[model samples]
Target: MNIAFRNESLPDKLFTILNGLIITVLFVSVFYPIIYIVSASFSDSQAVVSGEVWLWPVRPTLEGYSAVFNYNQVWVGFKNSVIYTVAGTAINVGMTVLAAYPLSRKDFYGKNTFMILFMFTTMFTGGLIPNYLLVKQLGMLDSVWAMIIPGALTVWNVIIARTYFQMSIPDELLEAAQLDGCNDLQFVWKIVIRLSGPILAVITLYYAAANWNQYFNAMIYLKSQDLYPLQLVLKDILVKNDIDVAMLAGDPADAAKREALKTLLKYSLIVISTVPLLLFYPFVQKYLVKGVMVGSLKG
Candidate 1:
């Protein structure tokens, strides 16, 4: 084997060096906050409150995580969030695929009209009050269905999936399937879906991430604390600063302790809340860029 180097022009070499520098800066800008937050989460409460921790933990301790997990509702919220994210994402992807497959087919009647209808929704919608009333009328408020059913699909995702199918799935393949006695349903389930892994991964990531972070809908539609998602629970704990008076009353520095712990918990809570999605993303990240670019090509 032999190695060779193309003697690049001076201008090209300079451009390459500059591009590398820019990319490094961008990476650092994005990564630095995560490092700071993780370090702060593990540092002592006073250190976190005083901003003494930066790239590394100062007086490192697990007090913040202990306080956060000690709250009983944290587990409940975790369970509910898992349920919502998994169920909601499943519904979202299923609906998007069902809609996109038909629209991708040239022979599907009223495709243009359906496309217009879906696109029109992106531009306008029935007012919030009406949507609320509709949900209330349907008896979905304060239920798990309220979280999953209302947002089962997005118009933008439908368009992307449709574009991916149109561009990637060939008509000749469908024709070949038909000649082999494959029905449309069998073809979609067996062939189309099997080949559509990239698009599926992209949409699954989008839906799963959205569902995990859902808070506003839970705030509006839920009346029971037991049904609250992790975001809402975190809000009450971190943002609202709800704490037990019994625990605070005995100590002379209780007020200061509460404030310090609150500061510490903020960072720990963020790490806890985002850990699932952070873990999940790397598995699907390889497909994300390719899926998004190819899916968005025609539309």
Candidate 2:
């Protein structure tokens, strides 16, 4: 029974078919790499190296995962990463809000001058060596502040947040808050922030991701391995191949066991590093999308 309504236009049908094919191709291109990585991570190193792993694992094994879990430094890196993400994100968000709110205010004096100074920083800088020297002079090197203080606020985030405040938070609300004897801090805390979920989520995700993925800063500033973030740890494991060969060595079947293990470890490292963000994204997905829209559009 073909009871469903259909527009009997040939062009429309052709367009629909073309669109679906293009979307399918795009999805496959995006998703296939992820599937391949997962499969290769689970597959035996030999199978992975021989290009046997495809959409599914070939000669499935847990050696890669076992290596990642058994490594003690991975845990230390994970802990440090969590700390950096939480603390750095807090500093970033707080500084961004403090900067943005003043700029958003119509009565704010010298906002243009301040904005120009901030934007000027985005275009020009003292370069990396000078920045490093400044951090050293400030005694932030090899310390937690090295991660947070240097990148306390982002200019782009400030602009987005300022725009969001101007467009989203009504002046009438501020006036009402003032009428009710609310001070600037009180109004910001009680009214402005409460109304700004989308932008907050957007910025939080941005800062958190940046902190979590930060390795270059830590690599340059921090000397102690204890202070190393997950990204730095990952760089060691994947790029440097800092793995113990005690177990993988002397295996009867595999001659290049250590090299094979390194290949497997690469995939496992990627999955372990990525899983946290995958879990975190779903909770804030709606807000993130809305925030991007609000930040992108001008009112």
Candidate 3:
């Protein structure tokens, strides 16, 4: 009987071990690339270029970061990115919330028609050239307004918000507010808006990321390098071989430092650019969950 019992348990034990191995393999495969890049970023560039450093950083130093910060253009780009993200997100959220609320209500006249019109834009656009011409015609070309106005409201965001409001917010709640003599604007502002935390947060992340990463518009519309966003500036740095020698003014050993700094700058800028969103998401992640669930209730 003892022998038979041991035999019975052996198969299950083997299966458990196999399952653990599979999961471990999956985890490593997914995480190794991220780890490799992060490690490489800190390693000596010669080691990186010669394929000497693999999984671990060798000869790690802050020279890369020092180089990145030393560049005036990087700071200028960072400042512009901040401006665009804050302004763009504010306009995007305000427009999305206001537009979605009315469409969520069943009693609103011409809602269906308006929704169809909005949806139509999502499927079909006036093409890039036409849009560019229109912007120029409106005298928005080369101006900050060119960035902010053109992408203020996304139809997809509107649809999602409308869906959330429809499913999550109760009609009876709106009726109660109405009975208390609350106007449409007041009701939306006080009641519906309060409950829409998650969806709003998601929208905020989307809009902010879009604005922060945007470069093509700046490349085309703005002639001044001073007005260039971080991504575009980063592009110039990454691609350009002969950066201004004046940019490397600090230490006496500028030549050696510049090489190491270039590699470090690549890593530092990536970290700096990505850190804001990582920090931002944790604070608003709970709201994103709530907003999506609530706002998507009807859509």
Candidate 4:
């Protein structure tokens, strides 16, 4: 028998069973929605509209995906969203690393004061109108810069990265690097970055997800439809009911079929928008727990 299993008391076994049950329930709760969306996306419009879909697609069809891809603006919005996510995530990770490295240093003067100021911004902000004025003054209105610059780096991410660096990077490593004639820049570039992969991945995922899903900033600042991100385009289709009748394949005169197709389109769009993050997540997931736990648990 396993040593751990042999040592378990009756109460411990009961607790383990309860914990497993709770976890299974939670997993199903989260997982069922994803399965439903995917099944509905592939399901025939009538099946979806009639509430026939359950664990699997009742009547499988690609009609929803077909309608979604046929829309020209969907492609434009997807391209723009990719651009924003990549460029914005790069700037975010770079700024976060730069800010975090210095703050992590014990010898750095006024770090506490700087940290306090950073924390202060998190608690209170200039609010929407003032932020809009600031963005307008900076000439970012209705431009790509509006999406990328205003929210370049999150202060909370900085704190997490800072905590991670403090906990993980030993003082002796820096001293050794200095003795080897490596300057601060070289040391950070060569050693700190190499060892800080987990934290970097964690923050990169954070920034990428934020940038990808963001539509509020685009809605507020961008007036041109050409600059719209995928989320904004989806908003127009789903919430504003902006779908064009020409995109539907069946007779445009049929009101009921059109409505059903529209409902199906919603599910398709959701899966399309969500797929990239789902694909990207697995690559960084191994790093996530270690990075988050080390930073949070130790400090």
Candidate whose lDDT is highest? 4
Model 2: pairs clashing at backbone N, Cα or C within 3 Å: none
lDDT of 1 by residue, 58-91 (tens): 9999988887777677879999999999989989
Model 2 bad stretches (over 4 Å)? 1-5, 246-254, 297-299
lDDT of model 2 at position 56: 94
- Total colliding residue pairs, candidate 2: 0
Candidate 2 per-residue lDDT, tens place, 1-299, comes to 13232654778677877998999999999999999998899999889887788789988889888878877788899999998899889989989999999999999999889989988998999999999999999999999999888989888888889999999898998898899899999888888888888888888898898889988999999999998998988888778877666634336466577687878988988998999888888888878767777667632
lDDT of each: 0.87, 0.86, 0.79, 0.92
* Prediction 2 global C-alpha lDDT: 0.86
Distance from true position, residue 52, model 4, in Å? 1.5
**What shift in Å separates residue 50 of candidate 2 from its native position after superposition?**
2.6
lDDT (10s digit) by residue, model 3, range 1-299: 45654676778868867988999999999988877767777776666666777788878855556666788888998998899889989999999999999998899999999999998998899898998899899998888888789889988888888888887899889888889999999988888878877777788887888888788887877777788888888777766644555665456566666565566567666767777777887878777766566545534
Residue-level lDDT for 222 in candidate 1: 96
Reference-based lDDT, residue 49, model 4: 96
TM-score of 2: 0.92
TM-score of each candidate structure, all chains considered together: 0.90, 0.92, 0.85, 0.92
For candidate 4, what is the TM-score? 0.92
Clashes of each: 0, 0, 13, 0
